[model samples]
Target: MKPIRIVCGTRESRQDFSTKTALGRSLLIHEAANPVDLMLFAENKQGLSSIYNRAIDEAKEDPAILVFVHDDVHLCDFSWSERLREAVETFDVIGLAGNTRRLAGQPAWAFVDDRFTWDEKRYLSGIVGHGSSFPCNVSNFGPVPQACKLLDGLFLAADSERLWEANVRFDEQFEFHFYDMDFCRSAELGGLSMGTWPLSVVHESGGAFGTPMWRESYRRYQAKYAEGGEPTPQETSVQKQTPVHQFHNPDLLKLMPTNAKRVVEIGCSSGALAREYKKLNPDVHYIGIEIDPSYAQLAREHCDRVLDMNIETVSAQLLAEDLAADCWVFGDVLEHLYDPWQLLQKIREASAPGSCVVACIPNAQHWSVQARLSVGDFRYEDSGLFDRTHIRWFTLVTMLELFTQAGLTVEAGVPRVFDEPQRERFLPAIHAMAAAAGRDPEMAVQDALPLQYVFRAVVS
Candidate 1:
């Protein structure tokens, strides 16, 4: 048999590349049938996609497998090269950890909804390490070699010739985030299969989720691949989005019953939606809580009372002192909280009888997001569903689950539907994912198309 030509690329700061990790040690172990060509970008200035693409361009020899790795990851298993050689023969894509099953509206294979009792088998065996060389715990999905829909990007060995032939390209648009899954997804979409090679490796840091940069990166990924469903009215061009002062969803008003005499609004900036809502029914008393003092001051004209305070620090006393509301309006606030789940429970406990919590939350798993992810780009912006300020995210299922966990029951849900133009734009990507999920494309479209979940959550 011909020797496997393995080429490797790693991203590391010049200062931090001072020492080699387990990956370095494992690559040194040579097999007579396998020769390795390593490429370490001096200081990973260019993103992984660019670096990987650059390596592919610069390769003097035809490599069977192209390896991309993080400098921190330790390849403790000496048989890693042998494993890679074996895996590449059968599978086009290889990773250390992955999931066989992918739930709908999920951002990634690693991401799981806590509300839904999940199959903990998403782990396919890997390790996470602290400062020490020793691993803390073994993340196991099941004994490999396993087939999975997604793979952790910490260590990836991909079939070069196959991907080249398929014209599958690692999306350069994705910076650091969503590259691994995006690559694997692209390969799979091109009829490439992925499997886990039980190689011993450990990652240093658990990822930071929901940061502005991460959200931006995620947004870009979503924009490119996640399309379809009910696209939000907020999903529009940058020129239209700029110089915006306030945002209020009329859908929140629809969630409230006509009899609602008192309503409290969280994150109510200048009560933009309030003015629109009051125009329809001016009798309803509105209490506004806004983090921006300027906006809160402006809200006073439309509201019975307006308080300038961060919702993260909002207290029961604040809500109870002014008015016993008929319902609480969280128009688009839950995802921005440091602890939305806790706040939901607090809101549930503080409210009086017959009061409900009505919120308009962006679906993180919207067809648009899923579509972009399918292609691998997540770009964050100043405003819209993926506004940089949003610190949390939820799917329709997880949103309902949040209400349930907060001692509330879902009274009703009103989805913000996509216009025909938007629907036409996203349908193709949504159908593709639906087909991959083994569900009826039409039903999947119906189930996953809503841009936002506007719901009434009442105390159970």
Candidate 2:
């Protein structure tokens, strides 16, 4: 039998769960017949979406088992590696603690006293710790392992491949608080089984429920699954018949490779480009990623598949693993990213080595921008390069570096030209700034150029 490969995912904190805590103590001494990878997310204003999405992407790199645990959790049992290996054999989803019966609008622990479950035999188990730990002061829901409708978030283990097959994940919208229950519901609805297992562990803090934000999240959760008090696969799906919008995307479309067999577009708003491309070659496969449910529903008219997922929180690896495209397109999309360079890295890592990226990125080096900044007038605009929504500002040099740093080589650069009249409108300010900064007027004009950049990229 192949050795079990595991990836332990966590939102890391100051506490040393990896080396100093109760779980860390057991991890240090356990010898298991398996390989494990650790993926820790830095909790710098990030949420569970980043961690869970990242973990799913890691599974693409290596088809392994996924074990998500809290940084505050300390596993105190020995031979944990071996025990986990044995326990996960029969369950698609396994947890250290879970509730057998989940009530509508009730939290996971609503039936804790009677619905508690632990281990394969449906026996009850638990432990407590200081600073709000349980069992020492509290108690296990009961003393038997039982099948459960929902599992606690603290210690969740699942086969990565099985999860991919089931097509369930930690919903990005849930972010931090309600993700555990949300995931449990998603898994159950997808026909995956949930079970509990024996483990000696200590959680440092009890949950904080009933906060204002918590209540808000709770309302959204309830609303999301309002169909018969539970959403069905068909009801929740976003693909539906939609009227085509008249959106055009010629700049990025022209850069597409001549023989492109498959194309995937990130930030594809209702598949405008896909619609046009399908008219040319109906046989070519096209896919899109749109965050808006309504937009994604309309995208089905143009794309073979539309994934309704936010680019900021979804993993590029996870998307690439499924699309396997000949070319990946990003039209006026990079500037909107939280970390464009990091996204570039993931794209390269996940896609086939020779696959290319075609992009249309705004030029911060445009003379109009320079002319405005020269007068100390950097004001947000409704749209264009200075669009208020643009989170990233990249000049020519930095824009070129995007491809290089992502381990991609630029095949060609195509400038999205602006008419001379536009440049002339800001020409006077350009010279004025040049004189103030003691630079040559011609050099200033040349330095501040390019309305936008459209490039064709391939893996280096």
Candidate 3:
């Protein structure tokens, strides 16, 4: 297949001209290094829409796919183009691109001017320029969806014929910003389909024009839209969706004793697992405790009983008296606590003797982690074993120690599935390490670093 043709447009700066020029040159060099075709254009302070239109016009005769990206953004994953192409074909949309904070609209102007506080959802509705790709189908002026009305400027693509026919030009009235929103709105009104896929590109928020341009744009929007009465912004509500566990560890679920009549799940987020337990043991009574009121409410709807209280603050005696549970679960909960062992001791005291304690703690010492640390990459973020909110970290040995100290005897211990690409990249090394550690070396790499360490222990 012919490689996609990517085009980028930027302006030369006198003060930072060398820096900006080097940046643009580096992008071209990187693109070539990836063996991808790239054509770049640098102009002096032209409207973004004008630059885009010129690039589109220049590439009109080329039979290859056209991809437009902002100069400020960096391509992290080299396979993004292929993934984006696949998504575009699957979704049948004109373009696919990355997520951005500033979208097209009036509220964004108010936000820029400090006239309004930031609402996480609406911040993007006002300024719409982003990275996007265009497919051949977009060559014909097509109807787009209402949801995409304000996001027109990011990375977008279209066929050569429709690009000229639709006269699909960004409104110069927007000058610096809002052109993307205007364009997307125009596309939607004219019947075109524009969408954003799960694939992403890294965008450095403010690399070009600084705060002055933002202030000016805010003034322009206020002048244009404020007089016409504020655009009735769309209201978006957080929807309650079912928790989909892609990593299935049935052995962890089996740890619950069949004869148990009562069960308690501490930190049951949305009560999904508790509901599963109820299904497994239909006659058993289940009670779940959650710190978040919203999740607790959802849990109540799914299970027989739910308590809206933080485990740390809730009196142990009160919880013990409320539900004399024979089985207690601490699934994926210990990592977030200040003192998991203390909580485990309380749970041990609260539950009946011989009650099963099913705990799922992510193994921090998994081989993949060791490799990442060996490379001097200790930076942590949300999710995974090193999730930012995790106040406590654990390894297989530490976790076993905690459970044993809590007066529990292990019945079963196994690793949970670790399927994330970054973590999976460490699997071969992990398998080798597991073998070196004199553990189950023959185990499949998929089983080497289970997403979590699931322990089924009986209270002794």
Cα lDDT of candidate 1 equals 0.66
Which structure among the candidates has the greatest TM-score? 2
Candidate 1: misplaced stretches above 4 Å?
A: 1-247, 420-426, 438-441
In what order do the candidates fall by lDDT, top score first? 2, 1, 3
The reply for model 2, stretches above 4 Å from the true place, is 1-245, 420-422, 428-444, 447-449
For model 2, how does the per-residue alpha-carbon lDDT over 1-460 read when each residue is reduced to its tens digit? 3234433334445356555444444455553532355565543355775677677776766776778776666656665666677677867787876765444344343332112222332333333343423345434655435566667777788878788877878888887777888888767544577777776667776776767877677777765643123322222332322233658568777778757788888877778888887777778878787655567667777787766554544344444655568888988878876678977777788777778999988889788787777789898766777776677988778988988998898988887776656677787778777789997877667657778888989976
lDDT (10s digit) by residue, model 1, range 37-99: 556675556787888776556443554567777766765655667777788887778887777
RMSD, every candidate, angstroms: 23.6, 16.1, 22.3
- For each candidate in turn, the TM-score is 0.45, 0.49, 0.42
Per-residue lDDT value at 106 in model 2: 47
Error of 2 at 281 (Å): 3.2
Give the local distance difference test score of model 2: 0.67
- Give the per-residue Cα lDDT of candidate 2 at 292: 52
**How much is the lDDT of residue 151 in candidate 2?**
74
The predicted structure with the larger lDDT, 1 or 3, is: 1
